[model samples]
Target: MTSITRLFDFPYYQQDKYISIPDALVTKQNGVWVKTSTEEYISKANAVSRALLRMGVKKDDKIAIISTNNRTEWNIMDIGVLQTGSQTIPIYPTISEDDYEYILNHSGAIYCFVSDIEVLRKINLIRNKIPNVLEVYSFNAIEGCKNWVELLKIGEDETNQYLVEEQKNKVQTEDLATIIYTSGTTGKPKGVMLSHRNIVSNVLNSAPRIPFEAGKSRALSFLPICHIFERMILYLYQYYGVSVYFGESIDKISDNIKEVKPTVITAVPRLLEKVYDKIYAKGTELTGIKKKLFFWAIDLGLRYEPYGANGVWYELQLKLARKLIFSKWKEGLGGNLDLMVSGSAALQTRLARVFAAAEIPVMEGYGLTETSPVISVNDMRNKGFKVGTVGKVIDGVSVKIAEDGEILCKGPNIMMGYYKDEKLTSEVIIDDYFHTGDIGEIDAEGFLRITDRKKEMFKTSGGKYIAPQLIENTMKQSRFIEQIMVIGDGQKMPAAFIQPNFDFVKEWAKIHKIEIGTTNEEITADPKVIARIQEEINRLNDKFGNWEKIKRFELTADIWSIEGGHLTPTLKLKRKIVMEKYIDLFHKIYN
Candidate 1:
């Protein structure tokens, strides 16, 4: 695949003859998705840029966007910001108020964009703290603020057109494009400065790996656009002319998947886990021969290797398994899903193999916000793609394991540095290689396998090092376990604080005629429930050595989530916050 000939120029991508811009970019209108054609998209974006110029916005100014995936407006704002040689500072709509206040103040944003009236109210409440913000515009109409579309009318003023055109011509590959504040599972969010070169290089090189046939490939965008992984892919969609559909909301993905019938989609492991969990839960409801077949198909899936050759009989069994069982799984994912890319965290090897066996190719990749988010991805082509590894490093990127086993990468995709934090930047990027805190290994064929976070490994009282992530992942395989956090620092044995799959257990309690209380606390305290969880732990304990095995656990029906501060927006565990909140639970396990 050739590099984008125009290099770091984003606006120029609109002009590519090979890349067919659709008749309409989709957006919700009157409770139904509507399209605004390619010409309209360009005209609207250009008009918005002119409006910014009319508002006295200057080059290099920071414009903050506080919105969910309003695909049409978000892209228009992004291109508008680009045309003016200004930079966008995107804040996750779900972040804490204090965090939002910190980002606004720190970024020195002069103009802000919000998704709706509720978001506008949030900005209005925090307006005093962020004194530099001169104006707030709402994508949805609000009583107090300017509407985003009104800005387009400002661009129509003949006086502003010349300046917008002049500013658009000034955008260069080396110019600062955006400042992304990572939603770290721990500590304060740092702004990662990405230039046009950093993101464009990633998109152009990474786009080809994705099987996109112009006019045929459609993508359902659900991941937070604020995240680099989704944003980079958004650009790839633009470059390759893939029709994109914005999910209504996280809860509506099921309906949207069916409506869009996307050939390709991107997701985090948690979403895929939910899909698996739902299917597993349904399968558990079957009985006799049907129940046996369900589990049998699942077991075969876990053993199915795409690259390795199983015997003729095994292959035949797999074929039967796909027809009888796996076909239903595909239909659930909208019947057109050819590729589902999972990233932001390590996908469980079991899930990866099972999905591949079902003929739903899940390409698990690895990277962080700092690496423009894709260091490596499993190729859907199945040529040499490994299930457990994060595939071979992408073209033009060099990855190696440090002596300490941390994955270090150097490439055009690497961010310039931490915005306005040189000392912190120097700590991570040494001799041009960005030190990824993940501990991983490169196999002989060049696939990368991430084991655990370098800082997350803890030692037991017996002086044996244990990776909690490994234990947590293994334990979560149980249908009863929704989330688990392993705990044991200088202790006799490792214990876990677990969030139970309450709905699943509720059904089990009824079937067994085990009376339990209504609330989470009461349900978790039931003796029968405890016994059932113990059985699961005992089964999983076979996979680990005695030192690494979880000796005990405290179950809770309390779900961990991003809003609860127990999870990052990307769904990685916020271990520190979770530990602080559940000290008593941990004590119960250890005691």
Candidate 2:
């Protein structure tokens, strides 16, 4: 067992761990044959810095990077930009042409590093719109773009190390490091400017909350590094010399986890749900005693609690079950895992509690891009670790409850401001406090429970308001629901558009002798499918008020994905886009 004393220090656990210009980034190379140690990372980064100088990149210039996750390439390019005193803008691989145009033009990025065909195509399509962009470097051997190897060859030349050192001398904590653009739920995206201090300070603050054992610690990174949660973790790893292993693709995270044997890695709720679904799928394949034991263990895990006292016999049984049953769960996650940190969206407390009880503690964190990502996190070691609360505020931060019960935070981790958005920035950031749009109540123990997003709470025509996220999370527990959006404002009652988990539904169909005929149209129209979805919807309605419940619903045959423009790059529901796309369904339900 890990020591409680080591895991936390009062006032949001921190370490004196310092990072500097001379610090080497820990990375892995292209072939998986090369592990770039911290020393090698610095050298390669300086070389890439030289290449940027040769490409005419200057201090304070914006350098856009378009890439899938590549450790060496991303770091060198990232640190290379930093070494030259220029800022890097890392765009998500899943982003669209319109967003690509807006970010490129808005940030005035002069150079972009493209790693894949799609990113290059996006840059090519938006070339005219982004007039200031001059150079494009591809990390892969794509035609018509300058190859990454060529840049590395020049980076290895050492001709500009003098120039690199010259540029590095000018870098400081107060300087704007990068501009992460958060797409608006309503209007245009706003660029959040985070300083070097903001990034580094958060890295330092978050260290003690996690389990880290020098060279032994590793992470399988799959989340979009463009998002600040993952991005700040990247910096945390860089500064602390933690080994970060990049997953080949979203498809390979499980297999890669086994290869990396990561001690800990961060995730959002959607990914965790998939992991749970996989375990459930495997359990279905077993039979008789095996199936019974598998199911019994799972049911126990679902209802397990760590905070309360239990009988010695029950505790011992749980311990034995964890070894015989749940240890494989960790082994599947690369065996060496100490924790799984979850954030960005609300993690259902039920999910968080189960994982923790199973020995795979999900340290649910809460924050936004505007706060350099991390604000509050649950330390598994903390005695008062509440199931539903998002833990206490992290070190070097002050959280206050506003008169309206809105959670307001003032911290070094808060962003400099929304770039070029003086009006919005002024409204949100008042008197050095970042006004988080979340309605939350802090308990006597100082743990914060998020009631809802302020903007998401909407009143009905009769004036009773409801928090949609709360309803949405509860509804998602249904096996049939792959996604859901609760719509109400101005209506007498709330209704929902539910996206059924087609894969699970198909499994049920197979068992029930329902003939799907290998086509989506037949399967969706099947009475079994409709009946199954309705059953789950009715089950979820038990917790909600009559008006707040999903009074009516529609299930679409089509799936919502990043490519489909239904979900955002971060796997968050694009509420506006999804509702507008299915206006007819809502209209029919309302009418």
Candidate 3:
């Protein structure tokens, strides 16, 4: 059996030495779940490699893929590009067209593959700008775009199999596998260059931390595969021979979860927050015994402690909660979900505890695109899990807290460097350690807890420092607050610009018979709505220092979203942009 070293070797490894199942990759097509076998997966990938070879693709050449969702075609194209000793540039489909032009030209990509017509439309808008791209292909056949099936037909002859083999053999584990452009909160995106070893080592090391039966577990993948967190998990799924079902889209995740009945999935904190809010909102609709039991279960969940640390009486009540109210919660998420790995941002500790109490554990991890993304993660096995922390560092990876509380990581999983920016790369990777730019501390038990982004922390005129994330995460636990950003970096006192839970406010208004208007603008401007939100702020503010508490705030009439230029693709607030967008609100709160 060939050892799995290169990124392309995962599928081949699964097919040859590992379990080869009939349903290796599944995708929902035309309202049906379509399965692609291991043999077919490899065959199509080889065909893609041969076709690229025929198209004059050479070693070190770049190919680009932009997809709106995770699908079988994306995986096939990824392996195909890597097999030809070429690097694949995976771009976020939601980014602006200017970014598309910059990345395509910067990477010197000779060919481009897009998932759907929306992506094709974006590419066509910048087609003239990206002159390096000789041709464009689409996974979904569009009117004027070249279809990927053409490549399959072009490489139908088996006579060229030896040439694909020649290229595969020449490819080393240290060779560049892909260039991932991070969706920065500010400025132009930097292309993070990762080698085959960087990702493969991360997969192998991080695999054991997640407990799943190799061939028996089914995974529902909805997160964008373009991100290393999800992409690495995809390769991990392949490595374990687990069958993967790609969700149609984010809007269809709940329905897809029901259809697939997957045992494991990956999620961001925002998605989980939405799920919890929806469930909580439904609970509010219940009355009498059901409503009492619902709140009882939630109260029990919020104080959850693992390893029977909450005592036997609490355990008994938790068992009752799980059997009654939490069981329905599980059913809503397809009933088979045993684990969810949360990354890309700090997950609220209460969300982690409550979900674990419901028997679906959310193991939150922390890392950036430069580290092949997994530095430390919470694992349930062997007491490696921690509620408020990001858990212990994975095996073969070492993490240390710097003098100023920055998390420094050193491991084989670290990226080679930022593509084409040596000065910027050298600034972060010093003394063989990658500076994570996140302020954190490793506990006595070795659990890492992130406090805030180093660059985001600020001091008021009073000379006391404030970590906005800590305040923001705590404030968001309020049912009335949907999103928030704490301000007053160099001002007199800490304040906030908030986007209230507009839907929840409407529901609350109905229950209380308040005369709040229907539109967001009218609702935000309502004095009654403002007073109620102030009550919530006063309640949650008791947990913070007086200096850190939000002294004043103004509500936004619109949702903060990626399309609004208020958030990054990963759902983190573009703080500068948010402040600029709400400058009037800022002045109203401070002045």
lDDT of 1 by residue, 1-591 (tens): 333432224434544544535633676666788776556777788888888888889999999998865478988898888879899998998888789898998888999999987677677778889999998888877786788888888887767778877886687777788999999878889999988888888887676677778655788888988999988887887676677788888898998888888888899988998889989889989999999999999999999787547788889999999999999888988998878888998788899999999988898888888988888888867574787888888888999899989999999989989988999999999999999999999988888899999889889999998888887888888888889988898898888888988887888888888888778888889888888999999999999999999888888667888889999888989999999999888777677
Candidate achieving the largest TM-score? 3
For residues 1-591, what per-residue lDDT tens digits would candidate 3 score against the true structure?
A: 658999999998888855467888999888989999888999999999999999999999999999998999999999998999999999989999999999999899999999999999889888889999999999997998899999999888878989999999999999899999999988898999999999999999999999989878899999998999999999999888889999999999989999999999999999999999999989988999999999999999999989999999999999999999999999998989999999999999899999999999999998899999999999988899989999999889999889999989999999999899999999999999999899999889999999999999999999999999999999999989999999998899999999999989998999899999999999999999999999999999999999999989999998999888898888999999999899998888777
* Per-model C-alpha RMSD: 2.1, 4.6, 0.9
Q: Candidate 2 residues 1-591, lDDT tens each?
A: 211121011101112232222222333446463465555555666677888788788888999887776455786677767778889887887778898999889999988888789788888987888888887889878888887667678777786689887776677777888998885565677899988778777877887776666434667777878888887787666544566777777887887788778878889998888888788789889999888878777877777767555567667778877887788787788788878888988888778866776788888888989888788988877564678888888899889989998989998889999888899899999999999999999998889899898988888777888888999899887667888888888888887777778888888878888776566666667777777788888888899887677777777767878888788777888888888899998888889
Q: What TM-score does each of the candidates earn? A: 0.96, 0.93, 0.99
| Candidate-wise lDDT, in order | 0.84, 0.77, 0.93
Off by over 4 Å in 1: 1-15, 18-20, 287-289
Better by lDDT, candidate 2 or 1: 1
Order the numbered candidates by TM-score, best leading. Answer: 3, 1, 2
Considering lDDT, which of the candidate structures 1 and 3 is the better prediction for this target? 3
Pick by TM-score: 2 or 3, better one: 3
Clashes of 2: 1
- lDDT score of model 1? 0.84
Give one clash count per candidate, in the order shown.
2, 1, 0
